[model samples]
Target: MDPQSALPAQLVRLAQEESFSPQRVLDAVHAALAPRTGVRRAEVLAHERGRLVVVARAGEAGPVPGACATFTLRHGGAELGLLHLHGGDPSTVDRAVGAAAGHHLAVALRDVTTAREQAELHRVTDAVRRLFEEGVRAVSVEAAGRLLVAVAADVLGTERAAVMLVAPDTRVTHVLGVGLPEELEQRLAASLLGRLARDSPAWQRAALTGGPDVVDAGGGPPGRPGGGVHSHRLRSKLKLPLMSAEGLVGTAVCGDVTRSRTWTPADRVLARRLALQGAVVVDNARLRELEQAHLRQLEHRAFHDQLTGLPNRAALLGALGDALDPVTGDGGVALLLIDLDGFKRVNDTLGHHSGDVLLQQVAVRLRELLPAGATGARLGGDELAVALAGPAADLAADLARAVHARLGEPYVIEGRTVRTGASVGIARAPRDATDTTGLLRAADEAMYRAKRAGDGPRTAR
Candidate 1:
């Protein structure tokens, strides 16, 4: 118990032992002190990231009789942990000797912790690389999320993991998880995501991309929606913001379901890396969708009349080609080419804008008069064409009559009543011509004949 006798104790000789570990040193310290000073128990504890965790213990696991002295072990202004001697006479152990051992032990703890981190990083490098590349190869945001959840569960050493997508307005739009219960996932989406939004001063704590947050809930039962709570399940959780140069995308989360845990700095670093990589994946998918939409718009514009929103001349020719294909197409085809008698004069008198309105109205009438298996198109100013298949072409004359009625009806252009007439030309395939070009030529000639004769419509065989 004397201070001088503590000079040559087991703590000092621990360095020479090749098999010395933290636990071995703790046992040795307890053995030397308990026998000499009559202390019943000892424990080494460290406060890391605001949590007091037991590092090593020797002797009684049950409650000690009394709290003796608490020794502070620190090095370079950092508090490593505390060496607490429980029970027995406090003055019987040499305080100076314990203090010296604690200081030396603190240095060792730092080195050992750093080495452990390095070793773990080496072990998980390949797994982390796959997670990062999964984002690159992901076909969609949902696909990326599935990969992220699985990778997070594997990397963080937990049974459950999830990715919650947040909209620009801070709404959790979607939730994806692996090994997470449906009810628990829903609860997390509302409660955990809400807490992250509210408590964060960052993922912007105000923006969608908040900072990383890890919590140790001490293995308690999460709130049940409408049912009574029973056993404790989810304990520790880590949530990191999924962010990229494009801004906040969502959040990545994982947790231990079997036992309680506190996330260490290494765990946090891994989560952040995964979240960021997954963000790129999501952003790329969004960009891809936008590009696809734009391409669809371009394709529509290419084959459609922008003015009247109808198929253009090229589309009409395509329809004619399809209708005239002997093997695949209907047995016979008909082409109706209509030339407006007074539309040019109206365009010349009115401005182009008024002419456009008249054309749009003409398109509307054409669409209304168009039969179910027919193609209608504006073949350049005042010249419109209609193509129909075998059975439908039998109504070509009737369709021409309907067109005459619809076009001859007064059009209200710019609040002024305007009247126009149409000269119709009808040509049937295998009678007038079998090919689209010849059929169209015959229709044009017949239309001219109707125009010259000043009759309503004319049919060419």
Candidate 2:
């Protein structure tokens, strides 16, 4: 059987194997051509730099004719190489067979290249996802950017990578990178950092087109003339927009040359993927921070009274319990229950609005008279409670005098002088009553006792 006759089957088998290495295809071609023309040996030569280079050879065939059968490997009108079979006559049949094999080889090579590229894309995607997930766990944007840059550098075979975020108000681009040069950082900050953030034509184009912009850094667009800075240092740079469902978030830039370098299509694709992952990580981190802040605010509001901005009844009780704990020793917790005497009469004489002002004034006095160790809460209309810790009798007398003196001073509300007095009842913990509720009741009873005793301003029991 002529080797030329077997060329088609051999080429088909090679294509079926899905191996498109240049050397492997050449080997198959050589095998098919060896025995077909009664030639002792055969060789397959590929066109390189306008001349044939022997890629694969077999048998003892002497130098074959240069013009036997020339087959060009082409796809979409681009010539990749030419196939030259040796150790055979330059026959019409040989040319036809070589042509068929060349066409199949070209198609196979294209498919293999595409598959390889797709597989690489999937790998990179998985890596970026993992990086972002790790960033989310750490709750640090810098850490996330570091991982992103590290991955990009590894993928693109470059030394440096950077992630820049546009500030919300100033629109300045802030570098969020693991290992970026100081010069690059400064330049980005002083020049393109903020000035070109939201308005840069290159950035806008990438964001709108959903593609990357490659610039031979320092080459295009003249910088300050006679300036000390050399633009040529930044040879190649790739700018990839970080986009999310909300729109463009920021950009990821990577380069090899400290001053400049050239960028490739593969590098752009990888940078864009990293940017996408980084945006998600950053967004999630910010949301978590916001949620935590909101939760703290809610907790604060829960334990505080809104009207007076003071600790409420619930909070007062908690504080009393802590103060009265046996572990706290005999520090002595004192409770004073205060009632506004003749407050309703004032509300009846003036309007409710004026009464509200009077009540606010009274709350202020109580807050001032109460010591730092003490807390006060409004126990509903015309009534309030103050808790403190000190020597029982002395604290009681001191607080009662303070409240009476402050209240008697009077308040000027809406340009009118208003007068009010408080009747106070004092009780001590573990001395007057055991628990918080009992202490409060004891204090209330003492207050009424003072009111009945006809004691005017400084009455306390």
Candidate 3:
């Protein structure tokens, strides 16, 4: 074979023969090139701290120092290994030929290194994605935070990770810890999370700036205007702010007990990514909780009077309907309707604020005098109804007299003395008409009669 052509031919053959292991490839190159280079044996030198150390050799024996020509093998800007051609006359392998061979072998040497790096990237990405999905599926803010630290510990290869959730007022609501040291974990879990957010410079900086922080001290991360704010129980930590479009929601702290665990570029990348995904999960869960609370409040307002905080006309009618249900045997329920006779005059005299105060006081009085199984409800302005469930006949008479006396009591409104009177009317189911509306009508007419006659209470006929 032609000498020039044989070199490239051997190069291709080497590629085919070796399975891309660094040590094995070096041995293969030595085998293929020894006879042609005249320097018939070789040693592979690893680049370490600006010096090359002979790590492997192949063929007749290792090369003699200063008796060989060296080719620096490099991949990109980084040096991989060196090829030292040994024995015979080194001039037989021209500089150009040796350099070419060195370049090709360098590419081969770094093949596994590059492949492993890419594989690590893929692995990190997959782990982060899996955790993100799991966090999104979490049922509550606390659950999502717990899942975050648990999975992050395993994926990021750490024993301590804490999630600090911040409230809108910039208070630390929770600090959830997983795999933390005993003392520090307990402090963060039970004591520290409730502290003001400003106490931790590392956390607040990351939160406000929406960036990352490295706290490399034992006393804890520094504060904005002061030295280390508090003991984070961390020798070194990476604090990643969990940001949302709404703002900084929290911070995720991944740390170790010693400064020996340096936070690498890849570690920072993975932690920041996990923090962002976790922020979304936590933010969504919190928003859902807020929305549900608001909906419950709306439902309450729907069925209740905002002014006096009693069941409104609609709720009262609904309850009365339930009481009148044949399945419940009429509930033997009786209705007592009371109308404050002087409410409109007070509204005209003292303004609506004082009027509202009077009505609230009236409701309090009526509620206190109510029978054991009674419900007190406000049927719009100045008209209130009470339902007493199967009370003794004497109890019914007592409730009416109590209503008339208690509701007639004077009230103090905005430092002014005021008095009001309630006209009471009583009606019973199946006796004073069978339906809810009819019972209400009977009670209304009787209440008007009592008001006109100065009677304390008039039962529906």
| TM-score per candidate, chains pooled | 0.57, 0.53, 0.62
Higher-TM-score candidate of 1 and 2: 1
Candidate 1: which pairs clash? 201-205, 202-205, 202-210, 203-209, 203-210, 203-211, 204-209, 204-210, 432-461
Q: TM-score of predicted model 2?
A: 0.53
Which is better, 2 or 3, measured by TM-score?
3
**Model 1 TM-score relative to the real fold:** 0.57
Q: For model 1, state the Cα shift of residue 428 in Å.
A: 7.1
- After superposing candidate 1, which stretches have Cα over 4 Å from the reference? 1-34, 37-39, 55-58, 72-78, 89-112, 115-298, 318-338, 349-351, 367-376, 386-408, 421-460
lDDT of 3 by residue, 180-297 (tens): 6577656665665566765665655675677667654444434433222244445667777888877787777776654446565666677778778878888887887778789989
By TM-score: ranked, best first:
3, 1, 2
Candidate 2's residue-wise lDDT over 67-115, tens digit each? 4455567877876555555545546347677676677666655565466
Q: How would you encode candidate 1's per-residue C-alpha lDDT over 8-89 as one tens digit per residue?
A: 4656677667655556776767776776677788777776645777778888878888766777768788877787889876
For candidate 3, report its TM-score: 0.62
lDDT of 2: 0.65
Identify the candidate with maximal lDDT. Answer: 1
269 in model 2: Cα distance from truth in Å? 3.9
